[model samples]
Target chain A: MKISLFATCLSDAFFPRVSEAMARLLARYGIRLTFPEGQTCCGQPAFNSGYWVEAKEAARRLIDAFRDSDYVIAPSGSCISMIHHHYPALFRDDPAELRMARELAEKSYEFSQFLVGVLGVSDVGARFPHRVTYHPSCHGSRLLGVKDEPLTLLSHVRDLDFVPLPFAEDCCGFGGTFAVKMADISAAMVTEKADHVRETEAEVLVGLDMGCLMNIGGRMRHRGQAVRVMHLAELLYEGVRMADERA
Target chain B: MSGHNPTSTLAERVRIALNNDFLRNAVRFTTERLRTNKQAAAEQIGNWEEWRERGRQIRLHTIAHLDYYLAQFAENLRRAGGYVHFASTAEEAVAITLQIMAAKQAKSVVKSKSMVSEEVHINQALEEQGIETVETDLGEYIIQLAGETPSHIIIPAIHKNKAQVAELFSEVAGEPLPADTAVLAAFARSKLRGKFLEADIGMTGCNFAIAESGSIVLFSNEGNARMVSTVPRTQITMMGMERILPSWEDLEVMATLLPRSATGQKLTVYMSAINGPRRTADGDGPDELHVIIIDNGRSRQLGDPEFQEVLNCIRCGACLNACPVYRHIGGHAYGWVYSGPIGAVLTPVLNEEKEKWAEVANASTLCGACYEACPVKIPLHDMLVYIRRRNVEEGRTKRTERLGMKTYKVAVSSHRFYQLALKLGRIGQKPLVRDGQIPTRLGPLKGWNNVRTAPALAERSFRESWQALERELQQEMAEMSPQVKARLEELAGKRGDRHEQ
Candidate 1:
């Protein structure tokens, strides 16, 4: 019943409301939550940029910080994927650290995966009236196999109309540092993604990962569109707040 | 329009590709068609994953014992009255090709679609020697007239639209031709048929070389490969050393995967397997056949752990169709004979010039679509990471980016430093923040803000709000009914048990 939050660095600094929403939603489900202050970035930027040694430094720090938690969950799919899939590979040379990394990976879960898979709660008795579309982040949908969990949960939300995003599985081009390193290609990909979002004609775009939302939402803002972007956690929390007010 | 000049920086070539709306539309249309076909074909072939795994295993086994299989292939080929020549480098391959051409007194040579010939610059080399070399494949012939290398592997003239093709073919025909597919095809067929009949040597690239039978296989939709291998009195097949299959049974797996992945066909129009030169009783076959096995830079990857699996590639170009970057920039921006995700990894690795081709590697988003699309399951995305790592280690990365990454590494490893940096960033963006986004192209945001705005930093860090949220959560949990709490706890316990198991 106890969960430790792994608020990714992006969420921690730029999208704090996502973590706040996650906390509120988990509490409504009668779950106990703790924040591990020592938690930092998941080393994805370094790891993805081919800086293995630097990534290992951050990985070891994360592993040590969450070494005692029974369940460590992150709001971001990409960071969780880095821990669950990449950590063991990072520590392959050292058996002790490798074992610890594997153990940590086993216990870590992406936020939506934790909600639908672990908690077995699809509808939290909440209502959302706006038309919404979902963008499945590449790491979450493909890498972590968190494909249907988010969609299934959204489908169960009371009064929420879910429109399927066209080319939903394609990446939003927030490839960590790739957004800057190959900005031109990244812009093109995000442009196409924004076009897809417009085609859906959804009022709000929801995704589990903040990195993707930031890129897509930023593009939407740049084009001066009125489409609102919300993290899945924020939407779920909004539902909980609405239900609580009615009660 | 020979392929984009290799000397131009990738950025320059990308600029060119971006500006050419026609090229972008052509590449996108062709790749989208190919991708849709491949998806449909994959669905038609049930248990696609199993088929892919089988293909990967076959390629892996062959590449693992490449030496033994290649030797067996050479022996079997020689036994079939074929001459085998080994070329360790591109220059050596060109030299061997020219030597055979001279020995046969070959004046006009016809070539089927061959990437290796492109790699070796064989057309230029042969033309330099006053030998007429005609590309027989329709796409190749179009690009050949354009004086450009292939942009896509399967569709070599992928960047050319029907109008462009008509223009290219018209120039070769000495008359204006309509922008009709049928007209272009007819023109190419008539012109190539003459060249195929008059040419003394026919040069083709091997798709898969059956080791046991010592037969080289060619898969083509246009049937040009058959002509290149049959009509000419002398035949030459250029093969990468890694293109080996242990037996015909293994070829079945490749046969299933290659066509489906390349163009989503159940089979290429022609899948020709030639054992050797024409036997005395054989009809409509070359009198003399020569097989050239070129290592070039492939041998450098034989024992390499990170890259050995790259040799397993079937060159299906599924990765190209699946890549977003390639879809935008086309193949020319790769600034090499090969382009797309495979080209991003292969161009640097094959050339062994990591520094020169580092920009090509950087061009990718590392999205792993290429890995997903690969029939042989080559970890091209991972190899790209390794390539980027090599670039960084070799100091091929930009100095500013290197310093930035170093600073990022330092800042992100600790929560305290990460928090401090965010606080600073929030304050530093006061002048830049407009309507909740940073829209100015300044400093590090120049490239990004040019096309898209970046989100302004949050006023409050999550860490600052967690304490209050945790307090509220504790109160809410305490107020929950006992029965509801027990049920949730029990459900959580069961889920945990299942996960542990």
Candidate 2:
């Protein structure tokens, strides 16, 4: 399977390791990966900040970048959701572009959804021994209905102890530009989320999207906590390496 | 406290709410309890989505043909010997209310928790005219005694704790009252009972007006609304024009959604449906009934596609309970009669002063939880976004934020610009980076870094390292086991064939 990676701008700029892990994990599964160099941002920050014209420009660029890919997958649920749910609405005024956007939306999938739903694979031959908890991103769980896919995949990992996150459905307050714009409210929310994470006493916090992890992890770091944050792809890749070494 | 002062910005009000630890805990506890009960009630009813859809359809059909339904309601009301008056503005509604009060020589009025009265400032208007007005609902009575506006819609005094309620009630009781719930409620019930008997006129907000029968429905737990509608000789009901439902059958859906969403009850303790005033043979009901249908900016949304659904709201407060921002800041931060997610949209749309009310729209995370929690399925999150976009198009946004968004747009549209900007950011962030996190509160990072540290930019971006990684991957894939490679190729070929079919 040829999968075009939509490494979100955040992953590309701040967390390149996430994209690397995604590539390694997919390659281990015998899926060839391609990167469309023309991709940049998903235009969520602009669109969510009420800059429709600017968001449209970014959307058009992304639409053009992955026009030919048979399958487009992204490690970030938020960016993938921006394409799968919001892109068609953005291009409603242009008929040809709207049709293309709709088609692209049908083929685009978040990382776990692509792995679990499209590939029909749950156990990716990975192993992990530490306790872990998953934070379901708002877009992933609510918008894209990617509920249980990440959990299903995680539950299959050998020796992985999964604890449920309390109040897991609540947003982490990393609402694109909302974090900076409404910093006070965002801080209060992330503080509550961090508290929940601490209650679970999970050594590592895993999430499908990097934006939420970055926000929660950054807060956890500032509070001088030792809990580590890892993307699901990175965790899965690490598990695969562990399994491979044990073999 | 009586109404939104409009003197402070939404940010300033939010800061005040944030600083109040007691208010935060009170709001959080009450909202959490309400949210849990609502979830259980929804589950108990089974097929909640179907009920929600039916409620949405009923509201859409009524609001779309509001003219016909409202006319039918007025005709039926008049046939029942009730007077229906149309008020186009707040002042007009107040004037109509005062006229009815004067004709009946009403000196004292008892109100039963009407948001429309708050919207029109009827109590203030009446008080200024030397008429005594009292709030009958326990929560409203507490806030009224404290001279504060309602913070939450369903629970008017949601920001007040038991201790605060005791203090407020003590002032009214002319004695120190204990903070016990039973003591406070008893004090209020007894005090309001006296006012209900002495008041010459009763005023209540219409929850849902049944168009076919011309009956006005009021949903309350305390039965004070029933008292207000029955004890006075003359009655006045203030209704937003969009509150009409076509028939009692439609009321079934609203009845299912409203109470469950508001208080999580199977039904409000008292669901009173009164048609006009008391007939000649009736006992313990109002002698004269007057219904005032107030437009008050609601007509502006009649044909508006973006905000017309906002009227479908049943004032359930489910959105408020579900909103994280509201849980933190409480209802006072919204600085209006309506608060929470609904207030974020309704305040701006219902008020003609968009320049000021538009600030309310900025007080949301656009998390869409409110949309998920809505009983009528009003797309409140989408409406909030539209409100923000309208504000920006109207040039109401801050210049700094506007310029920042523009720069972001230009940088994010091109990979070259985006990578260069990231590279620049990496260099610029060096002085601020400590332990792989930016901890300095400076410039744009001040607000963010104040509460949470930011991750430092990667030492090498993905794009810069991609070519080398690609070469390494090519070498690794070339040495892969033939069996695995053949199996993957065959699977890809099968997927391609399936796609072609």
Candidate 3:
């Protein structure tokens, strides 16, 4: 499968290794990944911040960039959800843009969703033995409906202890630009999430989206906690070796 | 009627609320508890999404044909020995309510948790007419005593902790009382029981009005709605015109969705369906029942494609729980009787005051959690965006903010402009940069940077880095595995076939 990887701007800049892991994992699944250079942001940051015109322009760039790709995959569920779900609505007035946007929306998938739903694989045979809890990103859970795929893959990891976090569905408060704009409220909300993570008795917290993980990780570091955070792709990639060795 | 306090804006009120530590803590605790309870109940229900869609369909159908259903409901209500009045404005609503008060020669009135009454400021109007009105809901009673408006829709005095409630209750009791829940509730129960029985008129909000049966349904855990409906000799119900459904089958969907969405309950302790005034054979219910259906600015939203769906809100605080903004600031920060996502949309649209409400829309993160949490699927985030867009279109935005957005639009629309802007930004931000961070204490950035320092632009842009990666990707795609490629082709074929169908 030829897949265009929209390694969301955030991951590309701050967490480049996540993209590296994503590329390797897709390759293992026999999916050839293409990085469409013309892609910028998913226009979510500006769009969410109420800069609709700017967001639309950015969306235009993105739509044109990967308009002909067989499949567009992103490691971040939130960003993938943005393109698949939000782009069509963002370009509702323009018929031409709307058509392309809808096509892109249909073709785009979150990494785990692509793996489990499209690839039809329950176990990518990833193994990470750390006790970890997952924070399902709000957009991915509710918008994208990537509910149990991440967790299902996580649960399959051999010898890994998966602890359930309390209020697992509650938002982690990293609402794109909302964190910078409403820091006080964001801090309070993330504090509650951090508290819940502390109570889960898990050594690490793993999430599908890097944005949420980064937000939670930053707070964890700020509070001087040693709990590690990693993306689901990285964990699944780790398990592939185990499955191969066992075979 | 109480005049608008020219001293403060909604933003100013929210500012005061944000500063009030006790109010914040109390509101947070109560909402969190209610949210938790709601979650547990939804889990217990088993097929929550199916139930949610059922509720959404009913609300959508009813609201789309609001005039037809409301007219049918009013006609049936009148036939059932009830008086129906239509109020086009809040003043009209108050006028009709006050006319009922005068006709009854009522000196005192008691109310349950009707948001319409608060919206109309009926209590202040009645008080101005030298008629005493009391709030019977315990939470509302406390806030009423405190001389304040309700901060939350469901839990009216959510901003007041038990200590604050005890203080307010003690003043009403003419004796000091403990902050214990049981003790406080007992005192309120006894105190309000007197008002319930003695008041000449009772008023309440309609949760949903059944069009087929001419009945009004209310859900309440505390039984105050029931008390307000049954106790007074004369009862008045204020309903939003859009609060109608086709039949009892739809009511079942509402019954399942409302309480569960609002407070995470399988059902409230009491769910009452009042058809009309008490019949000659009945032992209870009011002798004279009057329902004042208020449009107040809702009619303006009738044909509004971008906003009409907002009318489908069940006033379930699930949106509030799921709203990141509401969870932090609490309800009072909304600065109206209604708070949370619904409040942000409703306040401006209801009042037709875009200038004041434009700020309320800004309070949202537009995360769409409210839409997810909505049992009726109101699409509140989309509505919030629409409100902001309307605000901008109306030129209600501040000059600086408008100019900034215009500049942003220009720069982003053109590649040359965008690259130049980023370069200029990196250079322009040098003075503000202290330790590679833009610490601006001026402009709108002040509101943000006042709390947390902004991160400086990275050394290399992601757009720049993707070019090399793109070259590497083309080479890899050339050597793709045929097995996966075949699978992709099959899936594409299926999708194409489905589209053709």
Candidate 4:
């Protein structure tokens, strides 16, 4: 089975460590991940901004990139959500691309989803002693219904003190272009999210999507706070490394 | 109403709202309390999803056959001694209302909480003709006293605090009334009772119009709707054309959903259905009832695939409480009669100049929280995108924003260009990058940097490192275990996705 990586553009350009961590962690189970070079983006930025014509142009390339893979996984739930939730409608005009879009949607999965649902591996023999809180990005949890898979994975991690984020489901306001277009409103939203994360008083803030994590983490940094922000994949991988070093 | 575009642009309005700490905290506290109560109420009545779907189906069926149900409702209402008028425009609705007021020679009209009346600017119209119009509902009365429109569908004065309410009431009381809830309620109750007795007409907004029974239904916590409908000699009901339910049975679903979603009550304190004008034998009720069904751009949405489901909204304000944008800015920032997720969609769709209301749609993050919270399952998040698409198709978006998206299209069209763009981004950030992060408050980063640090591109992108990672992984590669492989194959055979909303 050819398992491919759809390194969402944000993960590809800004947080490459997320994909690297995902690749290393999945490799522990003998799953060799394939990187399809043709993929660039899921076209959510254009799609959300009402430029479906351009969004389709961006999406067609991505759908074709993973056409041959048996399964495609991404570290960010938002990107996978864009593929599975919007791609079919994005390509609705062309029947051929629509079929490929549907095919791509079926094979694609967010990282923890691919881990727990497909591999049936909730516990990856990882240990993290730090207190952490998770921010469920709105797109990932609401659009994709990826509510439990991440929680299940976190629950299985040894010695990981996880405090649930207050108002965990509220948007961090990193809505693709929304952060720029409606910046003030977006700032207010992220400010509230940062306040909640602070309320948790956790050492690290973990979330599924880089978009949300970046927004909240950026706000935390601006406020001169030292709360480490990480992708769930990166957190789990670091936990594995911590356990390995102890061993 | 307060949403009458007082501040001009949405950005300026949002700026003002964000700076108002008291308004933000008040909205946040109330919405949080309401949201928690709604969740508890919905959970206490198990299978909330089933109820939502049922309410959605009934609304869908009724709307799909709107013309048929509306005709039946009109005829039945006429037979039950109620006059029925259909208005296609806001002007027409107001004209019909004014004509009725003229016929009744109404000097004063007492009103319940009627969003439709607000939409028509009826109070201003009535006042222009030298007739008195008073809001009888507590929140509506408070906002009316402040010379503002309702900021919320259910909680009209959601943005106002008790002190503000006291201020509004003290002016009417001609004394220094304390900013106490009990004192304020007593003041309003006594003050409104006099108007209700002296008014020549009663006015109301219908929650649901039952087609089979020719009845108008109202759900209110204060019982003010009952007084509004029963007090005056003549009664006027203003209903949106889409507020029809096929029968009383369908209203049962709505009755269960509306109050719970609005304020987390299983049932409103007062639920009334007026079959028609008071029967000849009836001792107390409006002697003459007039039903004015107002279209006001609603008929345009009847067949529109993208926006039709928006009508499924029961005006519960659940979406408002769920919306993060609304939580920060409150209702007035929407700059129209409706606010929150529903307002974002409705303002653009229900107005003639779509371009003018375009920015209202951008206020949301397209977070889909509203859809999740909607009791009738209206897909507001998707509808917002469609509204934005309409704006884009008509050349309503900013030229620079359009150009930016077009440039983005070119960059992401192929992986090579996308890589080249990232390479450019990395090099472009060298001067701005401070210890691996771009904290500069310059250029496009101004708004973003004002609130948070912008991340600079990584030293090496994932794809740039993929080749080396693959070589390292090749040496460690092993065969997948049998059980996992079988699970993968089994998963590959299925087609339906749980993500399909």
Q: Candidate 3 on B1-501: residue-level lDDT in tens? A: 011232366556555666778877776787778777877888899898888888878777888888899889989999999999999999999999888888999998888888878888888899999988898888788888888887777877777788888888888889999999999999999988888889999999998899998999998888988889998999999988888888999888888888888887777799999999999898799999999999888889988888888888888788887776786677766766678889888877887666766677777766677887788888887787677767766777677766766676666555566656767877777777676556666875664454444556655554555566556654654344666567788987776776587
CAPRI-style docking class of model 3 based on DockQ: acceptable
Please identify which of the two predictions, 3 or 4, would achieve the higher lDDT against the true structure: 4
TM-score of chain B of 1: 0.96
Q: After superposition, how far is residue B15 of candidate 4 from its true place, in Å?
A: 1.2
**DockQ ranking from best candidate downward:** 4, 1, 2, 3
Q: Identify the runs in model 1 with alpha carbons over 4 angstroms from their true place.
A: B478-501
When summed lDDT is taken over every stretch of 10 residues in candidate 1 chain A, the lowest stretch is A24-33
Clashes of each: 5, 1, 4, 4
lDDT score for residue A161 of model 3: 92
Spell out the clash pairs found in candidate 3.
Answer: A125-A239, A126-A239, A127-A239, B38-B264
The alpha-carbon lDDT assigned to residue B497 of candidate 2 equals 72
Which DockQ value does candidate 3 get?
A: 0.31
Query: Given candidate 3, what's the lDDT at residue B385?
Result: 68
Docking class of 1: medium
Each model's DockQ score: 0.58, 0.54, 0.31, 0.84
Q: Which CAPRI tier for candidate 4?
A: high
Tens digit of per-residue lDDT, candidate 3, span A94-202: 8988878887888888988888888777776666678898898888888889998987788778888999988787788778766765566666678788889999878
Between prediction 2 and prediction 3, the one with superior TM-score is: 2
In the range B1-501, model 2's lDDT, one tens digit per residue, is 533667788878877888899999999999999999999999999999999999999999999999999999999999999999999999999999998988888899999989988999999999999999999998888888888899998998998899988887788778999999998888888877789989999999999999999999999999999999999999999999988999998998899899999889998899999998888788878989999999999999988888999988888899999998899999888887789999999999999988989878877777778988999999888788788888888999899989988888888778888888988998898887887778888898887888788888988988888888777776665244565556545655665675477
TM-score of each: 0.96, 0.96, 0.90, 0.98
Range of the 10 consecutive residues with the lowest summed lDDT in candidate 1 chain B = B478-487
Give the per-residue Cα lDDT of candidate 3 at B410: 65
Tens-place lDDT digits, model 4, residues B1-501: 344664488888888889998899899999999999999999999999999999999999999999999999999999999999999999999999999999998899999998988998899999999999999999999888888888888999898999989888888889999999999999999999899899999999999999998999998889989998887999999999999999988988999999889999999999999999999798789999999999998989988888888877789999999999999999988888899999999999999977678889999999999999999999999888888888889999989999998888998889999999999988899988988889988888998999899999999999999999999988877677899888887877554344343
